[model samples]
Every structure is written in structure tokens, then in C-alpha cells.
Target: MNEENTFETHRPRLFGLSYRLLGSRSDAEDVVQDAWLRWQQADHASIRDPEAWLVTAATRLGIDRLRAARVQRGRYVGPWLPEPAEIDEAPGPDHHAERAEQVSLAFLAVLERLGPEERAAYLLKEAFDYEYAQIAPLLGQSEANCRQMVHRARERVQAARPRFEVEPERHRKLLERFMHAASRGDQTAITALLREDARLVSDGGGKALAVIRPLLGRERIARLFWAAYRRRDPAIEWRMGMVNGEPAILRYRTGKLAAVMVATTDGERIVELLNVANPDKLGAGVTPDPGRASW
Candidate 1:
């Protein structure tokens, strides 16, 4: 295959790497596009490994974008969420379960605590299965330094990662019950399904109405959901689907997508709820219309 075809072959992995590092589909796309441009301009004849060259280029671009994004996110209103994306269930034979889990909102949230280089090193080693030797030059560090970055990032991510259910069916059932309870303003039932320390976070990007800070406690979360549904337009609809490899509730207002919600549970009860209401972030993974759905 030619250079264009070769780049096309690696686009998915390139996008995946950038997305995991940056946690924003648009930003990831920008990084991948930038990598493609660089690839076009580079003398491919001298490159022994096109994939490695592309991976290094994309990884560096992601690190720079993420650094800039951290600054902007600091000024963002409310909790910032990774833009949710529709996962392709069959992403070819190269897809790894570990990589799939890394795309989760819960996992991505943990990654936010990591610095740019640390995040890239950790992902390259863990998610992409790159060796320390391979990851060293990718981040412009020594192999030992890359290993240290991955080690530090791993500790932080593991400590902060929420314990979400691994079974998809059980997760879906739990969400269904929560949705049913919230739809009817059944705060008692809602509270019953939550862990005592359950937290609700929304990303409104200051463009939509959302809780400025994380709402904690089962009681508070229950009440917030109860009040939120009660105040919403009667015509708005809830559609259940999978997002970022987990079950999600997609809200629609007048047939337009409004928000996407996904909960992280410990099999028995939900420990965290993430709602993304930012319009700009909604365009990536979710379908605009998923037909009518009910709890």
C-alpha cells in the first residue's frame, strides 16, 4: 500500500492514542490531523517504521494539546468531563480489553490528575503495550524516566479510579432501575440504589445549566435528580444506550440531543454519576436521534 493507505491503516490507533491522552474527541482529531500533515511533509523513504514515527508525532501533539487544555479546563465552569464517544464494539482483532476500559469516564477522570508527560507515558505503556524503551523517546525522556512516569501515573490512576461494575448486563439493569426511579421522582428508590458517598458531577462548559461543583451524598444526589427531572420540559425524552463502553442515558429536548449521563457503580449501587451537557462535547460519540426510549 502507498503512504496514504498506510496512514489510513493506522488512523484508528492514532486517534485512540490521542483521545486517551487528551480525553477530548475534537482535540484528538486535531492531533491526528496534525500528525497526518506532518507525515505528508516528511520524507517517508528514510523512515524505517512509519507507525512508530506517526505514534511519536501524535503522542507529542497530544501532550502539548493536553497541557494547553489543562489551562483552559482550570477556567471551565463546573466539573470537566472527557467528551463521551460511541465505541465501536468490533474494533478489529487488535483491540485490547485494557484499552477499552481506559476509555471509560471513570478511568479518564482519574487520568486528569496526571501531568501530560505522565499521562502519555502511562497510556503508551499500559493501554498501547509500548515498552519503556519505546515510550522513552516518544515522550523525550530516558527509559528509566519513562518507567518512573508510568509508575507514578499508575499509582494515582489506581487510587482515584472508581470501582465500576464489569458486567454490562448488570450495569444496564442498574441504570434501568435508577432511570425508572428518577423518571417518577422516586427519591426513596433512587437513594436505595446509591452508595452513601455517591457523587453527581456535570460538565456544562458554562454554556448549559449544571451544578457548579460535584454534588455528594446519596441523599443530595437523589434529591438533585428528583428536582432535575421535575423541572425539565415534559416533552424531553430519555434514550438508553451504550457510551464509552458503558450504558448511558441520552436526554433529548425537542428531538435534539441535550445531555448524556453514565453512572459508575460497584455492582450493587452507583458510586458516581457523570452528566455531560456541554453542546460542543456532545457531537462526538452519540447519535443525534436514537428513537423513543423509556425506563
Candidate 2:
């Protein structure tokens, strides 16, 4: 293969690396573009192991962006949420799309609770399966320290997470059932499918109607959603879709995107709901119309 094909081959991994590190679709794409540009400018023959180099470059770029985002978030109103994107369940998926795809909103929301170093360590070591020694220099820490950081971050993230599979298709099925129950305003139906203490969190940035504090308990969540349906007087257009890889709903009315709801299941029951409803955050350009959805 030529130089173009060689670099093209590594694009997917680079995107995955950036998306995990930053948890934003647009930011990941930008990092990938930066890596691609750097590649275009470099002497291809001099570089060995293109994928490794690109991964390193993308990770570093994402880290830098994450730092800027930390500062920018302070100015954010209500809540801050990463941009959302759609994923197609069909074959021949693009690598960049796949990269943004895996960093689910549920996963990204978890990342928010972590410090940058911990987030980086977690993504690199856990998702990429990078060795401590390999990730050490990337984080500017000793190998031992990197290992500990990864271990600690993993514990926190895992603890915060509801035990679940990341399989997109199966996840989509569970979400469909969730939407159906929610739409019917069937509290018992919803509660029966939810964990006893399931949490529902929404990021409306205070621009939309969502529970500012996370709603806990199956009963409370069912009531809150039911209340919302009764309160909403406007006609809405929506459907099941994929956001950040897992099953979600893309809802809107007229022209503006109203909310993106993600459902997390613990195999037996739905455990969490993350609703992105912030209008300022709505400025982000994300596509979910062609989701990994089956109607």
C-alpha cells in the first residue's frame, strides 16, 4: 500500500484513542484530523509503526483539548455534556465514527467524575490494553505510578458503572422496550424493567425540562417521566437511535433537538438514564438520524 493507505489504515485506532480520551465526537474528529495532517506533513519513510505514533499523537491532542474543556466548562450554564453522535448498526462502519461510537454518554458522564490523568490512564490501559510501561511516558509519570492510576481510575469508574454489556444490537433491544414502557406512562411496567434504585440523570443545561438532580429509584423515575409527558404540551418527533454507541432516543420538535436519552441495563433491569437536554449544548453538530436502530 502507498503512504495514503498506510495512514488511512491507522485512522480508526487514532479516532478511538482520541474519542476515549476526550469523550466528544467533534473533538475526536479534530484530533484525528490533526494526526492526519501531521502525518501528511511528515516524512512517511522515516516513521515506523504508524498506528502507535498516531495513537500517541491523538491521545496527546485529546489531553490538551481536555485541559481547555476543563476551563471552558466553568463558564457553562446548568450542566455540561459532551457532544452526541449517531452510529449505524450496519456493516462497513467508518473508523472515526466507530471511535466516537464507543465513548457512550453513560461512559462519558462517568469520565466527568474523574480527573484528566485518571481518565487518560483508564482509557489507555483498560480500553486500549496498553501496558503500564507503554502508558507511563504518555502521562508523564513513572510506570509504577501509571499502573496505580489506571488501577484506581478503573475501580472508581467500575464502581460508578452499572454492570452491563457494550454490545450495541442487544443494547438496542433493551432500549426499545424502555421507550415503549416510558411512552405508555406505565409506571409498573417501567418499574418492573428497572432496577429498584435506578438513577435517571438529564443534562438540559437548565434550558429544558429535566430533573436537575439525578432521579433515583424506579418509582421516582417512573413518576418523573410520567409527569414530563403530562407537562409536555408540544408535539414531538422522536425515535430510537444510538448515541455514543449504546441505545438512545433522538427527540426534537420543529427544528431544535430537544433531548438525547440513554438507557443502561443491568441485564435484568434498566439501571440508569442519561438525558442530554441542554440547549446551549444543543449547538453541537451531532448526527443520530441514521442510528444503530431497528424499527
Candidate 3:
């Protein structure tokens, strides 16, 4: 295969690695593009493993972007959620639950607590199933050091990540109920569908109206949604779809995209609601489908 063909074959996995590392689609794209540039100038005949070389380049670029993003995120306006990706419909029965768990917005949020290189090491080993020996050279660290990074990062992620119901049908059903309740301003119904300690985070990035802090507690969240629905604009439309390999609500204003919401549920009740409202983060991998109106 030609260099371009080889790169194209590995592009999806490359983007997946970068996106998981940086938690931003645009940044991931930049990393992939930069890797492409490096690939174009490299001597392919001397490169025995094209995938390994490209993965190493993307990982390093992602690490650099993550370092810069950490500083920028420190000054961000409100809660920062990962940019939601538009994934295809859920796969068949043979699909692994781990794939969805690894890419969920909730998992990405947990990953934010780790340092850049640590995050890369952990993701490569755990999410992408790369061996520590393979990951050590990619991050320019010793194998033992890479193992430590994965261990520490794993502990932090496991402790902080929200519990998500893995069954797609069950998760979708619960989200449907919540959205319907929210649409009707049914505070009682909404409250019933939430865990007592449920948290709702909206990332508007100061470009739209959003709560400056996370709304805690099911009751408070219920009231907030009630108030929001009371002020709902006639032009606003909502659709139910899958984002980040999970069920989500896509909010559109005047036929333009506004926000994407995904709920993390603990089987029966929602444990967290991640609403990405920042305009800059909405359109990367998704487009509005005119046929599937949920509201």
C-alpha cells in the first residue's frame, strides 16, 4: 500500500487516540493533520511499521496540545465538557461495552484530572490496548514508568468517572423519559428520573446562556429544567440521537445547532447530565437530521 493509503487506513484509530487524549475534536484533527505533515516528509522505505510511527507522532502532538489546553481551560468560563462526537448508531450484539465506556463524555471528563503524558500513557495502554513496551517508546518514557503512569491514571479515572448504564436500550429509554419530562416542564416526573445526588453540568463557554456552576441535587436540577422549559422559545427544536456512543438530545435553535446533551445513568436514574452548549464545540462530528424530531 502507498503511504497515503496506509495513513488513511489508520486515520480513525489515530483520531480516536487524539480525541481521547485531548478531549477536543478540533485539537485531535490538528494533531492528525500535523502527523500527516510529518508522514509526508518522512522516508517511508526506512519505516518498518507505518502505524507505529504515525501513532507516535499523533501521541506527541496530542501531548503538546493537551499541555496548551490545560492552560487555556484553567481560564475557561464555566464547566468544561469534552466536545461531543457524532458516532454512528450503536453496533450489533457483538460490540464490546468497553468501547463505548472508553469514549463516553463522562469518561473523558474523568480523564481531565490526569496530566498530559499520564493521560496518553493510560489511554494507549487501557483504551487502545497497546502494550506498555509499545507505549514507553511512544511517550519517550521507560516501560516501568509508563506502567506507573497507567496505574495512577487508572485509579484516578475509576474513582471519578460516573456510573453509566451500559445497555443501549435501557439508557436510551431513560433519556427519552427525562427529555419528555423536561419538555413538558414536569418537575415531578423529572425528579423521579434522577438520582438524589444527580449533577447537571452545562458548558456554554461564555458564548451562550448557561449556569456558571454545576447544578447539584435532583430537586434543584428539576427546578432549573422547569424554569428553562417555561422560557422555551418556539423556534427551539430537539432531537434524540447518539453522541459519543451513547444516547443524547440535540437542541437546535431556529434550525441551527445549539447544544448536545448526554446523560450518565446508574441503571434506573440519571447520575449526571453533560450538556455541551458552547457553539464552538457542537458541529464537529454531527449534523442535524431533519427527519428525526423528538419534540
Candidate 4:
């Protein structure tokens, strides 16, 4: 295949890798574009594997961006959540269960805790199934060192991972009930749907109204939602959709993106609620139809 066709063929995977590593669509796109420019200027005739070369370039770029982002986010207003990406309605090779799990907001949030090199090693090893030996060269480390990094990153991620695994349908049902309760300002109903220790985080980027810290406990979360409902805008429309392969509520104000709310459930109840209201992070354009009450 020609260089142009080869680059186009691997664009999605490159973007996926970069997005997972950076947790920002814009940054991921920029990394991919940079890789493209590098590719254009390189002597492709001497390269044996274009995919591997592109992946290495993009991943390195993403790692650099992640390091900068960590510092930038420290000054961010309110809790910061990964920007949501809309998955296709029909599952494709790129939107399979494994890929979805890797890109899930919950997974991305946990990933944020790892150092950039550790995160890169973990993603290359676990998400992309790259061997330790293969990852070592990309990260400029020995194979054993790469293994150690992956091991450490795995322990950290597992510790913060969700405790329960709820089926997709059940998760959606729980979200529906939680949304219904929140919409009606039914504190009792909402509290019943949340775990006693459930936490709610909102990211407003200092440009909008959001709690400066995570709201802990079911009571606090329910009260916050109740207050929001009381002051809810009539023009804002809430629709059920999929975000990061899980059920989410997309709130639109007069047809413009307002907020994207995603929940982490443990089959029976929600343990965490992430509300992304930052206008800067809400431009991915993931809109799904308003499905019926029943799945």
C-alpha cells in the first residue's frame, strides 16, 4: 500500500492510542497530526513497519502531553473528568467490549493516577497486548524495567478499579432510575439508588458552576441534585445515551451541549457520579436518540 493509504488505515488506531493515553480528544488529534507530519517528511522507503513507527511516535507525543496536562490540571477548577467520546450505536471492531472498557471514563480516571511512563507501559501492555520486550524500546527502557512499570501501574489501577461488574442492561436501568429520581427532585428516591458512600464529581473548568470538591455521601449528592432540579432550565433536554461504552445522560440546553453525566454502578447501586459540564470538554458531539424507558 502507498504511504498515504497506510497512514489513513492506521489513523483510528493511532487516535485511539493517543486518546487513551492523553484523555483529551484535541490533544490526541494533535499528536496524530504531528505523527502525520513526521511521516510525510520521513524516508518511508527504509521503514519496515509503518504501524509500529507511527504508534511509537504518537505514543511518545501523548506521553509528553500527559506530563504537561498533569501540571495544568492541578490548577483546574473543580474535579476534572476525562472528556467523553460517543461510541457508535452499532458495535464495530473499534468499538468492541475490550476497547470500550479501556476507554471508559472510569478506567481513564483511574489511569490518571499513574505516572506518564507507567501509564504508557500499562496501555501498551494491557490494552494493546504489546509484550514487555516490545514496550521497552518505545519507552526507552529495558524489558525488565518495562515489566516492573506495568506491574506497578496494574496494582495502582486495580486498587482504584470498580468493585462490581454490572451487566449493560442492568447498568442502564440503574442510570434510568437515578436520572428519573434526580429529575423529579426526589431525594429519597435518589438516595435509595446510590450507595451510602457514593461520590459525585463535577467539572466546570471555572467557566461554569460546579462544586470545587467532590461531593461525598449519598445524602450530599442527593441534595445537590435536588437543588439543581429546583433550578433546572426548562430548555435543557436530558437524553439517555452511551458514553465510553456505558450508559450516560446527555443534558442539552436549547440544543447545545450542556453536561454529560456518567455513573459507576455496582449492579445494585451507583457508587460514583461524574458530571462534565465544562463547555471546553463537552464538544465531542456524542448524541444518541432518546431510547424508550425499557431497554
What do the candidate models score in CA lDDT, each in turn?
Answer: 0.83, 0.72, 0.86, 0.84
What lDDT does model 2 reach? 0.72
lDDT of 2 by residue, 1-295 (tens): 8877987888878877777777676788888898888878888788787776777777787888889988987776555666674433222333222323237777777888888888888888878889888888777899988888878887888888745654556566677787877776778788888889898877776568766677789999988767766766466656665565556776766744677787777666778887888765554545534443422
- lDDT, model 4: 0.84
Residue pairs in steric clash, candidate 2?
204-277, 204-278
Error of 1 at 106 (Å): 1.5
Query: Cα lDDT for residue 70, model 3?
Result: 93
Question: In lDDT terms, how accurate is model 3?
Answer: 0.86
State, as a TM-score between 0 and 1, how close model 3 is to the true structure. Answer: 0.92
Candidate 2: segments with Cα more than 4 A from true spot = 1-4, 43-46, 87-102, 165-174, 232-234, 255-257, 279-295
After the best TM-score superposition of candidate 1, give how far the Cα of residue 95 lies from its true spot, in angstroms. 17
Every model: Cα RMSD to truth: 3.9, 4.8, 3.0, 3.9
Between prediction 1 and prediction 2, the one with superior TM-score is: 1
Work out the TM-score per prediction: 0.92, 0.80, 0.92, 0.92
- Residues 1-295 of candidate 3 have per-residue lDDT tens digits of 9889999999999999999999999999999999999999999989999999999999999999899999999999999999976633323445333436788898899899999999999999888999988998888899999999999998898789845445777887899899889888899999999999999999999998899899999999999989989997898877676787677777779877788888888788999999989999976786445454643
- Better candidate by lDDT, 1 or 3: 3
Query: Mind sharing the TM-score for model 4?
Result: 0.92
- Which segments of model 3 are wrong by more than 4 Å? 87-99, 162-165, 290-295
